[model samples]
Target: MTVKTRIYLVRHGETAWNAGGKFQGHSDIPLSERGRKQAKALAERLSNLKIDAFYSSDLSRARETAGILAEPHRGTVYYLPELREINFGRWEGLTFKEIAEAYGELSTRWWASPLTIQIPAGESLQQVVDRCTRAVAGIITRHAGETVVVAAHGGVIRVIVGAALGLDLNHFWQLRLDNVSLTVLEYHGPEKAILELFNDTCHLHEK
Candidate 1:
Protein backbone atom coordinates (compact mmCIF):
# COMPACT_ATOMS: atom_id res chain seq x y z
CA MET A 1 0.00 0.00 0.00
CA THR A 2 1.22 3.48 -0.89
CA VAL A 3 1.66 5.75 2.09
CA LYS A 4 -0.26 9.00 1.83
CA THR A 5 1.03 12.14 3.49
CA ARG A 6 -1.74 14.29 4.91
CA ILE A 7 -1.42 18.04 4.95
CA TYR A 8 -3.80 20.35 6.73
CA LEU A 9 -3.68 23.80 5.16
CA VAL A 10 -5.13 26.40 7.48
CA ARG A 11 -5.73 30.08 6.80
CA HIS A 12 -4.80 32.31 9.69
CA GLY A 13 -7.54 33.92 11.74
CA GLU A 14 -8.91 37.33 10.95
CA THR A 15 -6.99 40.51 11.63
CA ALA A 16 -8.08 44.14 11.87
CA TRP A 17 -7.26 44.58 8.22
CA ASN A 18 -9.43 41.62 7.24
CA ALA A 19 -12.41 43.10 9.03
CA GLY A 20 -11.77 46.41 7.26
CA GLY A 21 -11.62 44.71 3.81
CA LYS A 22 -8.18 46.07 3.11
CA PHE A 23 -5.46 44.24 1.27
CA GLN A 24 -3.00 43.14 3.94
CA GLY A 25 -0.41 41.57 1.71
CA HIS A 26 2.95 41.20 3.39
CA SER A 27 1.87 43.21 6.42
CA ASP A 28 2.96 41.97 9.84
CA ILE A 29 -0.23 42.84 11.65
CA PRO A 30 -1.17 40.79 14.72
CA LEU A 31 -4.52 39.02 15.04
CA SER A 32 -7.56 40.74 16.46
CA GLU A 33 -9.14 39.55 19.75
CA ARG A 34 -11.76 37.68 17.76
CA GLY A 35 -8.98 36.05 15.77
CA ARG A 36 -7.26 34.84 18.95
CA LYS A 37 -10.47 33.28 20.21
CA GLN A 38 -11.09 31.67 16.83
CA ALA A 39 -7.64 30.12 16.86
CA LYS A 40 -8.19 28.72 20.31
CA ALA A 41 -11.47 27.21 19.21
CA LEU A 42 -9.84 25.68 16.17
CA ALA A 43 -7.18 24.23 18.45
CA GLU A 44 -9.85 22.51 20.47
CA ARG A 45 -11.50 21.10 17.35
CA LEU A 46 -8.16 19.66 16.20
CA SER A 47 -7.04 18.41 19.58
CA ASN A 48 -7.73 14.80 18.78
CA LEU A 49 -5.77 14.68 15.51
CA LYS A 50 -2.25 13.27 15.68
CA ILE A 51 -0.20 15.93 13.93
CA ASP A 52 3.36 14.98 13.05
CA ALA A 53 4.59 18.49 12.28
CA PHE A 54 3.39 22.07 12.18
CA TYR A 55 4.50 24.88 9.91
CA SER A 56 3.49 28.50 9.40
CA SER A 57 4.30 31.70 7.61
CA ASP A 58 6.66 33.94 9.54
CA LEU A 59 4.09 36.73 9.75
CA SER A 60 2.83 37.41 13.26
CA ARG A 61 -0.79 36.46 12.57
CA ALA A 62 -0.02 33.10 11.00
CA ARG A 63 2.74 32.31 13.47
CA GLU A 64 0.48 33.00 16.42
CA THR A 65 -2.30 30.85 14.98
CA ALA A 66 0.12 27.99 14.42
CA GLY A 67 1.43 28.39 17.94
CA ILE A 68 -2.06 28.04 19.35
CA LEU A 69 -2.64 24.79 17.46
CA ALA A 70 0.83 23.43 18.18
CA GLU A 71 0.58 24.08 21.90
CA PRO A 72 -1.76 21.15 22.44
CA HIS A 73 0.23 18.63 20.43
CA ARG A 74 3.61 20.05 21.36
CA GLY A 75 4.43 19.61 17.68
CA THR A 76 7.52 21.24 16.25
CA VAL A 77 6.59 24.39 14.37
CA TYR A 78 8.68 25.40 11.38
CA TYR A 79 8.57 28.90 9.96
CA LEU A 80 8.59 29.15 6.17
CA PRO A 81 9.04 32.72 4.99
CA GLU A 82 8.16 31.76 1.43
CA LEU A 83 4.65 30.92 2.58
CA ARG A 84 3.96 34.65 3.15
CA GLU A 85 1.17 36.49 1.37
CA ILE A 86 1.64 37.84 -2.14
CA ASN A 87 3.32 41.24 -2.26
CA PHE A 88 0.77 43.82 -3.37
CA GLY A 89 3.50 46.37 -4.12
CA ARG A 90 2.16 49.92 -4.18
CA TRP A 91 -1.32 48.50 -3.69
CA GLU A 92 -0.56 47.04 -0.29
CA GLY A 93 -3.04 48.01 2.45
CA LEU A 94 -5.41 49.58 -0.09
CA THR A 95 -9.07 48.74 -0.30
CA PHE A 96 -10.60 47.40 -3.55
CA LYS A 97 -12.33 50.71 -4.36
CA GLU A 98 -9.23 52.66 -3.43
CA ILE A 99 -7.16 50.61 -5.84
CA ALA A 100 -9.72 51.08 -8.60
CA GLU A 101 -9.83 54.82 -8.01
CA ALA A 102 -6.05 55.11 -7.95
CA TYR A 103 -5.18 52.85 -10.89
CA GLY A 104 -8.47 52.73 -12.81
CA GLU A 105 -8.24 50.40 -15.80
CA LEU A 106 -4.87 49.09 -14.70
CA SER A 107 -6.39 47.71 -11.53
CA THR A 108 -9.13 46.01 -13.50
CA ARG A 109 -6.61 44.46 -15.81
CA TRP A 110 -4.63 43.29 -12.82
CA TRP A 111 -7.64 41.49 -11.37
CA ALA A 112 -8.64 40.08 -14.71
CA SER A 113 -5.15 38.91 -15.66
CA PRO A 114 -3.25 38.34 -12.47
CA LEU A 115 -1.03 35.60 -13.81
CA THR A 116 0.31 37.65 -16.69
CA ILE A 117 0.30 41.13 -15.18
CA GLN A 118 2.86 42.09 -12.59
CA ILE A 119 1.95 44.48 -9.82
CA PRO A 120 4.29 47.45 -9.98
CA ALA A 121 7.02 46.79 -7.37
CA GLY A 122 5.28 43.53 -6.38
CA GLU A 123 4.88 39.93 -7.41
CA SER A 124 2.67 38.53 -10.14
CA LEU A 125 0.36 35.62 -9.51
CA GLN A 126 2.83 33.36 -11.23
CA GLN A 127 5.53 34.59 -8.90
CA VAL A 128 3.39 33.76 -5.90
CA VAL A 129 2.73 30.30 -7.34
CA ASP A 130 6.43 29.67 -7.74
CA ARG A 131 7.28 30.64 -4.18
CA CYS A 132 4.37 28.77 -2.62
CA THR A 133 5.04 25.69 -4.73
CA ARG A 134 8.64 25.62 -3.61
CA ALA A 135 7.69 25.88 0.04
CA VAL A 136 5.04 23.16 -0.24
CA ALA A 137 7.29 20.83 -2.21
CA GLY A 138 10.03 21.21 0.34
CA ILE A 139 7.71 20.44 3.23
CA ILE A 140 6.20 17.37 1.52
CA THR A 141 9.64 15.97 0.77
CA ARG A 142 10.72 16.31 4.38
CA HIS A 143 7.56 14.84 5.89
CA ALA A 144 6.27 12.26 3.45
CA GLY A 145 3.54 9.93 4.80
CA GLU A 146 2.99 12.08 7.90
CA THR A 147 0.22 14.44 8.89
CA VAL A 148 1.38 18.07 8.79
CA VAL A 149 -0.39 21.33 9.41
CA VAL A 150 0.55 24.53 7.60
CA ALA A 151 -0.88 27.82 8.80
CA ALA A 152 -0.67 30.56 6.21
CA HIS A 153 -2.53 33.39 4.45
CA GLY A 154 -5.55 32.96 2.22
CA GLY A 155 -3.71 34.02 -0.90
CA VAL A 156 -0.89 31.58 -0.20
CA ILE A 157 -3.34 28.79 0.49
CA ARG A 158 -5.12 29.47 -2.80
CA VAL A 159 -1.94 29.25 -4.81
CA ILE A 160 -0.70 26.15 -3.00
CA VAL A 161 -3.98 24.38 -3.71
CA GLY A 162 -3.94 25.47 -7.30
CA ALA A 163 -0.43 24.19 -7.83
CA ALA A 164 -1.28 20.85 -6.30
CA LEU A 165 -4.28 20.52 -8.59
CA GLY A 166 -2.29 21.55 -11.70
CA LEU A 167 -4.60 24.52 -12.19
CA ASP A 168 -3.57 27.79 -13.74
CA LEU A 169 -2.70 30.61 -11.39
CA ASN A 170 -5.26 32.85 -13.08
CA HIS A 171 -8.02 30.71 -11.60
CA PHE A 172 -6.72 31.15 -8.06
CA TRP A 173 -9.73 33.20 -6.95
CA GLN A 174 -11.92 30.15 -7.48
CA LEU A 175 -10.61 28.73 -4.24
CA ARG A 176 -12.39 30.51 -1.42
CA LEU A 177 -10.31 30.38 1.74
CA ASP A 178 -11.94 32.07 4.69
CA ASN A 179 -10.24 33.25 7.86
CA VAL A 180 -9.47 30.31 10.20
CA SER A 181 -10.63 27.84 7.56
CA LEU A 182 -8.95 24.48 7.08
CA THR A 183 -8.07 22.65 3.83
CA VAL A 184 -6.78 19.13 3.60
CA LEU A 185 -4.43 17.72 0.94
CA GLU A 186 -2.89 14.29 0.61
CA TYR A 187 0.18 13.22 -1.28
CA HIS A 188 0.23 9.56 -2.29
CA GLY A 189 3.55 9.44 -4.06
CA PRO A 190 6.30 11.48 -5.62
CA GLU A 191 3.96 13.27 -8.00
CA LYS A 192 0.38 12.41 -7.12
CA ALA A 193 -1.63 14.68 -4.82
CA ILE A 194 -5.27 14.85 -3.84
CA LEU A 195 -7.33 17.65 -2.32
CA GLU A 196 -9.54 16.11 0.33
CA LEU A 197 -11.14 19.29 1.58
CA PHE A 198 -11.12 23.06 1.11
CA ASN A 199 -12.22 25.99 3.21
CA ASP A 200 -13.80 23.93 5.97
CA THR A 201 -14.86 26.19 8.86
CA CYS A 202 -16.92 23.75 10.90
CA HIS A 203 -15.15 24.81 14.08
CA LEU A 204 -16.53 28.32 13.67
CA HIS A 205 -19.97 26.98 14.54
CA GLU A 206 -18.81 26.66 18.12
CA LYS A 207 -17.70 30.27 18.26
Candidate 2:
Protein backbone atom coordinates (compact mmCIF):
# COMPACT_ATOMS: atom_id res chain seq x y z
CA MET A 1 0.00 0.00 0.00
CA THR A 2 1.31 3.46 -0.84
CA VAL A 3 1.52 5.69 2.19
CA LYS A 4 -0.36 8.93 1.90
CA THR A 5 0.75 12.03 3.71
CA ARG A 6 -2.11 14.18 4.98
CA ILE A 7 -1.77 17.93 5.36
CA TYR A 8 -4.27 19.89 7.41
CA LEU A 9 -4.08 23.39 6.05
CA VAL A 10 -5.64 25.89 8.43
CA ARG A 11 -6.13 29.57 7.90
CA HIS A 12 -5.32 31.58 11.01
CA GLY A 13 -8.18 32.93 13.11
CA GLU A 14 -9.71 36.33 12.55
CA THR A 15 -7.75 39.46 13.30
CA ALA A 16 -8.78 43.06 13.76
CA TRP A 17 -7.66 43.69 10.25
CA ASN A 18 -9.64 40.71 9.07
CA ALA A 19 -12.80 42.03 10.69
CA GLY A 20 -12.22 45.41 9.14
CA GLY A 21 -11.48 43.91 5.75
CA LYS A 22 -8.08 45.54 5.75
CA PHE A 23 -5.16 44.02 3.94
CA GLN A 24 -3.09 42.17 6.54
CA GLY A 25 -0.34 41.00 4.28
CA HIS A 26 2.82 40.42 6.32
CA SER A 27 1.77 42.95 8.95
CA ASP A 28 2.59 40.81 11.99
CA ILE A 29 -0.62 41.70 13.78
CA PRO A 30 -1.59 39.64 16.79
CA LEU A 31 -4.87 37.75 16.86
CA SER A 32 -7.89 39.56 18.22
CA GLU A 33 -9.92 38.18 21.16
CA ARG A 34 -12.37 36.63 18.72
CA GLY A 35 -9.46 35.15 16.83
CA ARG A 36 -8.07 33.59 19.98
CA LYS A 37 -11.42 32.02 20.75
CA GLN A 38 -11.69 30.77 17.20
CA ALA A 39 -8.26 29.19 17.42
CA LYS A 40 -9.17 27.44 20.65
CA ALA A 41 -12.33 26.11 19.06
CA LEU A 42 -10.44 24.83 16.06
CA ALA A 43 -7.88 23.28 18.38
CA GLU A 44 -10.62 21.39 20.15
CA ARG A 45 -11.99 20.27 16.81
CA LEU A 46 -8.65 18.74 15.79
CA SER A 47 -7.60 17.46 19.21
CA ASN A 48 -8.45 13.91 18.28
CA LEU A 49 -6.48 13.74 15.06
CA LYS A 50 -3.17 11.90 14.99
CA ILE A 51 -1.08 14.78 13.94
CA ASP A 52 2.61 14.02 13.49
CA ALA A 53 3.86 17.49 12.73
CA PHE A 54 2.79 21.09 13.23
CA TYR A 55 4.00 24.05 11.23
CA SER A 56 3.02 27.68 10.81
CA SER A 57 3.91 30.94 9.24
CA ASP A 58 6.26 32.92 11.47
CA LEU A 59 3.70 35.69 11.70
CA SER A 60 2.20 36.07 15.16
CA ARG A 61 -1.39 35.35 14.15
CA ALA A 62 -0.58 32.07 12.46
CA ARG A 63 2.00 31.14 15.09
CA GLU A 64 -0.50 31.63 17.88
CA THR A 65 -3.12 29.54 16.10
CA ALA A 66 -0.59 26.75 15.56
CA GLY A 67 0.42 26.99 19.18
CA ILE A 68 -3.18 26.42 20.24
CA LEU A 69 -3.66 23.49 17.88
CA ALA A 70 -0.37 21.88 18.88
CA GLU A 71 -1.24 21.83 22.58
CA PRO A 72 -3.36 18.65 22.65
CA HIS A 73 -0.76 16.61 20.78
CA ARG A 74 2.26 18.06 22.63
CA GLY A 75 3.86 18.93 19.31
CA THR A 76 6.34 21.59 18.38
CA VAL A 77 5.39 24.03 15.65
CA TYR A 78 7.99 24.59 12.96
CA TYR A 79 7.90 28.22 11.92
CA LEU A 80 8.46 29.03 8.26
CA PRO A 81 8.67 32.57 6.96
CA GLU A 82 7.98 31.20 3.52
CA LEU A 83 4.41 30.55 4.60
CA ARG A 84 3.72 34.20 5.32
CA GLU A 85 0.93 36.02 3.48
CA ILE A 86 1.53 37.85 0.26
CA ASN A 87 3.11 41.21 1.09
CA PHE A 88 0.60 43.91 0.24
CA GLY A 89 3.14 46.73 0.51
CA ARG A 90 1.26 50.02 0.47
CA TRP A 91 -2.02 48.15 0.55
CA GLU A 92 -1.27 46.71 3.95
CA GLY A 93 -3.76 47.99 6.59
CA LEU A 94 -6.09 49.41 3.97
CA THR A 95 -9.60 48.31 3.11
CA PHE A 96 -10.56 47.24 -0.39
CA LYS A 97 -12.55 50.42 -0.80
CA GLU A 98 -9.60 52.41 0.41
CA ILE A 99 -7.32 50.61 -1.98
CA ALA A 100 -9.70 51.29 -4.85
CA GLU A 101 -9.86 54.93 -3.91
CA ALA A 102 -6.13 55.22 -3.66
CA TYR A 103 -4.85 52.95 -6.40
CA GLY A 104 -7.78 53.03 -8.88
CA GLU A 105 -7.08 50.93 -11.98
CA LEU A 106 -4.11 49.25 -10.36
CA SER A 107 -6.32 47.93 -7.58
CA THR A 108 -8.87 46.80 -10.15
CA ARG A 109 -6.21 44.94 -12.03
CA TRP A 110 -5.02 43.39 -8.78
CA TRP A 111 -8.47 41.94 -8.21
CA ALA A 112 -9.01 40.89 -11.83
CA SER A 113 -5.56 39.58 -12.73
CA PRO A 114 -3.73 39.09 -9.47
CA LEU A 115 -1.46 36.58 -11.15
CA THR A 116 0.03 39.30 -13.25
CA ILE A 117 -0.68 42.42 -11.21
CA GLN A 118 2.16 43.63 -9.02
CA ILE A 119 1.39 45.47 -5.79
CA PRO A 120 3.54 48.56 -5.91
CA ALA A 121 6.17 47.19 -3.55
CA GLY A 122 4.55 43.87 -2.61
CA GLU A 123 4.65 40.33 -3.89
CA SER A 124 2.65 39.12 -6.84
CA LEU A 125 0.40 36.08 -6.52
CA GLN A 126 2.92 34.07 -8.54
CA GLN A 127 5.60 34.92 -6.01
CA VAL A 128 3.31 33.72 -3.23
CA VAL A 129 2.67 30.49 -5.15
CA ASP A 130 6.40 29.93 -5.55
CA ARG A 131 7.44 30.48 -1.94
CA CYS A 132 4.43 28.93 -0.17
CA THR A 133 4.43 25.84 -2.42
CA ARG A 134 8.14 25.40 -1.80
CA ALA A 135 7.55 25.32 1.95
CA VAL A 136 4.68 22.85 1.45
CA ALA A 137 6.95 20.66 -0.69
CA GLY A 138 9.55 20.62 2.03
CA ILE A 139 6.95 19.69 4.63
CA ILE A 140 5.61 16.84 2.51
CA THR A 141 9.11 15.46 1.95
CA ARG A 142 10.05 15.75 5.60
CA HIS A 143 6.91 14.09 6.90
CA ALA A 144 5.99 11.66 4.18
CA GLY A 145 3.21 9.22 5.17
CA GLU A 146 2.50 11.27 8.27
CA THR A 147 -0.23 13.79 9.08
CA VAL A 148 0.91 17.39 9.45
CA VAL A 149 -0.78 20.68 10.30
CA VAL A 150 0.06 24.06 8.84
CA ALA A 151 -1.47 27.29 10.16
CA ALA A 152 -1.14 30.14 7.72
CA HIS A 153 -2.89 33.09 6.08
CA GLY A 154 -5.88 32.96 3.77
CA GLY A 155 -3.90 33.97 0.72
CA VAL A 156 -1.15 31.49 1.51
CA ILE A 157 -3.55 28.59 1.99
CA ARG A 158 -5.41 29.46 -1.21
CA VAL A 159 -2.28 29.33 -3.32
CA ILE A 160 -1.16 26.05 -1.79
CA VAL A 161 -4.52 24.35 -2.40
CA GLY A 162 -4.77 25.71 -5.92
CA ALA A 163 -1.28 24.45 -6.67
CA ALA A 164 -2.10 20.99 -5.31
CA LEU A 165 -5.11 20.85 -7.66
CA GLY A 166 -2.97 21.87 -10.66
CA LEU A 167 -4.70 25.25 -10.77
CA ASP A 168 -2.51 28.15 -11.73
CA LEU A 169 -2.22 31.59 -10.14
CA ASN A 170 -5.04 32.96 -12.29
CA HIS A 171 -7.57 31.11 -10.14
CA PHE A 172 -6.14 32.67 -7.00
CA TRP A 173 -9.36 34.22 -5.71
CA GLN A 174 -11.49 31.18 -6.40
CA LEU A 175 -10.37 29.21 -3.34
CA ARG A 176 -12.27 31.14 -0.60
CA LEU A 177 -10.38 30.45 2.60
CA ASP A 178 -12.12 31.97 5.59
CA ASN A 179 -10.38 32.74 8.86
CA VAL A 180 -10.07 29.67 11.08
CA SER A 181 -11.22 27.45 8.23
CA LEU A 182 -9.74 23.99 7.77
CA THR A 183 -8.61 22.37 4.53
CA VAL A 184 -7.11 18.93 4.07
CA LEU A 185 -4.81 17.73 1.32
CA GLU A 186 -3.58 14.17 0.88
CA TYR A 187 -0.42 13.56 -1.05
CA HIS A 188 0.12 10.08 -2.46
CA GLY A 189 2.93 11.30 -4.70
CA PRO A 190 4.26 14.36 -6.50
CA GLU A 191 1.41 14.43 -9.00
CA LYS A 192 -1.20 12.67 -6.93
CA ALA A 193 -2.25 15.24 -4.40
CA ILE A 194 -5.95 15.23 -3.53
CA LEU A 195 -7.90 18.03 -1.92
CA GLU A 196 -9.94 16.16 0.61
CA LEU A 197 -11.42 19.24 2.22
CA PHE A 198 -11.65 22.94 1.55
CA ASN A 199 -12.71 25.84 3.78
CA ASP A 200 -14.43 23.81 6.42
CA THR A 201 -15.58 26.10 9.24
CA CYS A 202 -18.02 23.90 11.06
CA HIS A 203 -16.02 24.14 14.27
CA LEU A 204 -16.62 27.85 14.36
CA HIS A 205 -20.32 27.14 14.85
CA GLU A 206 -19.55 26.60 18.48
CA LYS A 207 -18.45 30.16 18.79
Candidate 3:
Protein backbone atom coordinates (compact mmCIF):
# COMPACT_ATOMS: atom_id res chain seq x y z
CA MET A 1 0.00 0.00 0.00
CA THR A 2 2.80 2.40 -0.73
CA VAL A 3 2.10 5.02 -3.38
CA LYS A 4 5.11 6.70 -4.94
CA THR A 5 4.99 9.69 -7.22
CA ARG A 6 7.98 10.90 -9.19
CA ILE A 7 7.92 14.57 -10.08
CA TYR A 8 10.38 16.29 -12.35
CA LEU A 9 10.49 19.98 -11.56
CA VAL A 10 12.13 22.10 -14.19
CA ARG A 11 12.77 25.79 -14.60
CA HIS A 12 11.99 27.17 -18.02
CA GLY A 13 14.91 27.99 -20.30
CA GLU A 14 16.53 31.36 -20.49
CA THR A 15 14.63 34.35 -21.83
CA ALA A 16 15.95 37.69 -23.09
CA TRP A 17 15.04 39.28 -19.78
CA ASN A 18 16.70 36.52 -17.80
CA ALA A 19 20.10 37.22 -19.33
CA GLY A 20 19.74 40.87 -18.47
CA GLY A 21 18.66 40.02 -14.90
CA LYS A 22 15.45 41.92 -15.39
CA PHE A 23 12.33 41.06 -13.45
CA GLN A 24 10.06 39.05 -15.73
CA GLY A 25 7.35 38.09 -13.32
CA HIS A 26 4.09 37.39 -15.11
CA SER A 27 5.68 38.53 -18.37
CA ASP A 28 4.88 36.42 -21.39
CA ILE A 29 8.42 36.43 -22.71
CA PRO A 30 9.50 33.88 -25.29
CA LEU A 31 12.54 31.67 -24.99
CA SER A 32 15.84 32.79 -26.48
CA GLU A 33 17.63 30.83 -29.20
CA ARG A 34 19.96 29.17 -26.72
CA GLY A 35 17.01 28.50 -24.52
CA ARG A 36 15.29 26.51 -27.25
CA LYS A 37 18.36 24.37 -27.74
CA GLN A 38 18.59 23.73 -24.04
CA ALA A 39 15.01 22.54 -23.99
CA LYS A 40 15.70 20.16 -26.85
CA ALA A 41 18.67 18.73 -25.03
CA LEU A 42 16.58 18.15 -21.93
CA ALA A 43 13.89 16.51 -24.00
CA GLU A 44 16.38 14.08 -25.41
CA ARG A 45 17.75 13.25 -22.01
CA LEU A 46 14.30 12.60 -20.54
CA SER A 47 12.65 10.93 -23.52
CA ASN A 48 13.34 7.43 -22.29
CA LEU A 49 11.56 7.95 -19.00
CA LYS A 50 7.94 6.96 -18.63
CA ILE A 51 6.52 10.39 -18.10
CA ASP A 52 2.78 10.05 -17.49
CA ALA A 53 1.91 13.74 -17.57
CA PHE A 54 3.37 17.15 -18.33
CA TYR A 55 2.50 20.43 -16.67
CA SER A 56 3.70 24.01 -17.01
CA SER A 57 3.01 27.54 -16.06
CA ASP A 58 0.67 29.41 -18.36
CA LEU A 59 3.45 31.81 -19.37
CA SER A 60 4.79 31.48 -22.89
CA ARG A 61 8.37 30.72 -21.89
CA ALA A 62 7.35 27.90 -19.58
CA ARG A 63 4.79 26.43 -21.96
CA GLU A 64 7.26 26.45 -24.83
CA THR A 65 9.92 24.78 -22.73
CA ALA A 66 7.50 22.09 -21.57
CA GLY A 67 6.27 21.59 -25.12
CA ILE A 68 9.76 20.77 -26.30
CA LEU A 69 10.30 18.27 -23.51
CA ALA A 70 6.88 16.64 -23.84
CA GLU A 71 7.13 16.18 -27.62
CA PRO A 72 8.92 12.82 -27.45
CA HIS A 73 6.45 11.32 -24.99
CA ARG A 74 3.41 12.81 -26.72
CA GLY A 75 2.45 13.78 -23.20
CA THR A 76 -0.47 16.03 -22.46
CA VAL A 77 0.73 19.38 -21.17
CA TYR A 78 -1.50 21.14 -18.67
CA TYR A 79 -1.20 24.84 -17.99
CA LEU A 80 -1.87 26.06 -14.47
CA PRO A 81 -1.97 29.77 -13.81
CA GLU A 82 -1.01 29.18 -10.19
CA LEU A 83 2.37 28.01 -11.38
CA ARG A 84 3.14 31.45 -12.85
CA GLU A 85 5.92 33.59 -11.37
CA ILE A 86 5.25 36.05 -8.61
CA ASN A 87 4.12 39.45 -9.83
CA PHE A 88 6.79 42.13 -9.47
CA GLY A 89 4.35 45.00 -9.82
CA ARG A 90 6.03 48.25 -10.88
CA TRP A 91 9.35 46.46 -10.93
CA GLU A 92 8.21 44.05 -13.57
CA GLY A 93 10.98 44.82 -16.02
CA LEU A 94 13.52 46.41 -13.73
CA THR A 95 16.78 45.03 -12.43
CA PHE A 96 17.73 44.93 -8.76
CA LYS A 97 19.62 48.18 -9.01
CA GLU A 98 16.70 49.90 -10.67
CA ILE A 99 14.32 48.70 -8.03
CA ALA A 100 16.74 49.75 -5.30
CA GLU A 101 17.03 53.23 -6.77
CA ALA A 102 13.30 53.62 -7.17
CA TYR A 103 12.11 52.21 -3.87
CA GLY A 104 15.29 52.58 -1.76
CA GLU A 105 14.62 51.39 1.78
CA LEU A 106 11.41 49.70 0.79
CA SER A 107 13.27 47.64 -1.78
CA THR A 108 15.76 46.52 0.83
CA ARG A 109 12.95 45.60 3.14
CA TRP A 110 11.20 43.66 0.44
CA TRP A 111 14.29 41.59 -0.20
CA ALA A 112 15.03 41.06 3.46
CA SER A 113 11.48 40.29 4.53
CA PRO A 114 9.51 39.28 1.47
CA LEU A 115 7.29 36.99 3.54
CA THR A 116 5.61 39.97 5.19
CA ILE A 117 6.22 42.78 2.71
CA GLN A 118 4.02 43.16 -0.31
CA ILE A 119 5.19 44.93 -3.43
CA PRO A 120 2.89 47.45 -5.05
CA ALA A 121 0.35 45.45 -7.06
CA GLY A 122 2.56 42.41 -6.58
CA GLU A 123 2.34 39.24 -4.49
CA SER A 124 4.02 38.41 -1.21
CA LEU A 125 6.15 35.35 -0.66
CA GLN A 126 3.41 33.87 1.50
CA GLN A 127 0.87 34.37 -1.26
CA VAL A 128 3.08 32.60 -3.77
CA VAL A 129 3.75 29.78 -1.30
CA ASP A 130 0.04 29.26 -0.75
CA ARG A 131 -0.87 29.21 -4.43
CA CYS A 132 2.04 26.97 -5.39
CA THR A 133 1.30 24.62 -2.52
CA ARG A 134 -2.28 24.16 -3.65
CA ALA A 135 -1.24 23.65 -7.25
CA VAL A 136 1.39 21.05 -6.33
CA ALA A 137 -0.99 19.26 -3.98
CA GLY A 138 -3.58 18.97 -6.70
CA ILE A 139 -1.07 17.70 -9.23
CA ILE A 140 0.29 15.10 -6.80
CA THR A 141 -3.21 13.93 -5.94
CA ARG A 142 -4.24 13.55 -9.58
CA HIS A 143 -1.09 11.72 -10.60
CA ALA A 144 -0.35 9.54 -7.60
CA GLY A 145 2.01 6.63 -8.27
CA GLU A 146 3.01 8.19 -11.58
CA THR A 147 5.85 10.18 -13.08
CA VAL A 148 5.24 13.75 -14.20
CA VAL A 149 7.17 16.75 -15.48
CA VAL A 150 6.56 20.37 -14.63
CA ALA A 151 8.07 23.36 -16.41
CA ALA A 152 7.79 26.63 -14.57
CA HIS A 153 9.59 29.85 -13.67
CA GLY A 154 12.48 30.13 -11.22
CA GLY A 155 10.42 31.91 -8.58
CA VAL A 156 7.68 29.35 -8.77
CA ILE A 157 10.19 26.54 -8.56
CA ARG A 158 11.73 28.04 -5.44
CA VAL A 159 8.40 28.35 -3.72
CA ILE A 160 7.38 24.82 -4.64
CA VAL A 161 10.69 23.34 -3.53
CA GLY A 162 10.64 25.26 -0.28
CA ALA A 163 7.17 23.99 0.53
CA ALA A 164 8.13 20.42 -0.28
CA LEU A 165 11.19 20.62 2.00
CA GLY A 166 9.48 22.54 4.80
CA LEU A 167 11.82 25.46 4.35
CA ASP A 168 10.87 29.02 5.04
CA LEU A 169 10.19 31.29 2.12
CA ASN A 170 13.05 33.57 3.19
CA HIS A 171 15.42 30.63 2.81
CA PHE A 172 14.26 30.00 -0.74
CA TRP A 173 17.36 31.74 -2.04
CA GLN A 174 19.39 28.72 -0.95
CA LEU A 175 17.91 26.71 -3.78
CA ARG A 176 19.43 27.34 -7.19
CA LEU A 177 17.14 26.84 -10.18
CA ASP A 178 19.12 27.56 -13.30
CA ASN A 179 17.33 27.87 -16.62
CA VAL A 180 16.52 24.47 -18.13
CA SER A 181 17.84 22.67 -15.07
CA LEU A 182 16.05 19.53 -13.84
CA THR A 183 15.03 18.80 -10.24
CA VAL A 184 13.43 15.60 -9.06
CA LEU A 185 11.12 15.13 -6.10
CA GLU A 186 9.44 11.98 -4.87
CA TYR A 187 6.15 12.07 -3.02
CA HIS A 188 5.39 9.11 -0.78
CA GLY A 189 1.81 10.03 -0.10
CA PRO A 190 0.51 12.97 1.94
CA GLU A 191 3.10 14.91 3.98
CA LYS A 192 5.87 12.63 2.88
CA ALA A 193 8.31 13.77 0.20
CA ILE A 194 11.97 13.45 -0.64
CA LEU A 195 14.27 15.55 -2.81
CA GLU A 196 16.08 13.26 -5.20
CA LEU A 197 17.83 15.97 -7.21
CA PHE A 198 18.06 19.73 -7.64
CA ASN A 199 19.46 22.02 -10.32
CA ASP A 200 20.81 19.27 -12.51
CA THR A 201 22.34 20.54 -15.78
CA CYS A 202 24.18 17.45 -16.97
CA HIS A 203 22.39 17.50 -20.30
CA LEU A 204 23.51 21.06 -20.90
CA HIS A 205 27.09 20.13 -20.06
CA GLU A 206 27.01 17.33 -22.58
CA LYS A 207 26.39 19.80 -25.37
Which lDDT tens digits does candidate 2 get at residues 124-191? 89889889878988898899899999999989988888888888667678778899999999998655
| Cα lDDT listed for each candidate | 0.90, 0.91, 0.91
State the local distance difference test value for candidate 3.
0.91
> What does candidate 1's lDDT look like per residue over 51-163, in tens digits?
99999999999999999999999887899999999989898889999999999988989888898888878888888888888888888888888999999999999998888
User: Against the hidden reference, what TM-scores do the models get?
Assistant: 0.96, 0.96, 0.97
Which residue pairs in model 3 clash with each other? none
Q: Write the per-residue lDDT of candidate 3 for residues 76-163, one digit (tens) a residue.
A: 7999999999988888999989999999998988888888889988988899888888888899899999999999988888888788
**Total backbone collisions for each predicted model:** 0, 0, 0
Arranged by TM-score, best first: 3, 2, 1
Candidate 2 clashes: the total is: 0
TM-score, structure 1 vs. true:
0.96
How far is 20's C-alpha from truth in model 3 (Å)?
Answer: 0.8
Off by over 4 Å in 1: none
What C-alpha lDDT, on a 0 to 100 scale, does residue 184 get in candidate 3? Answer: 91
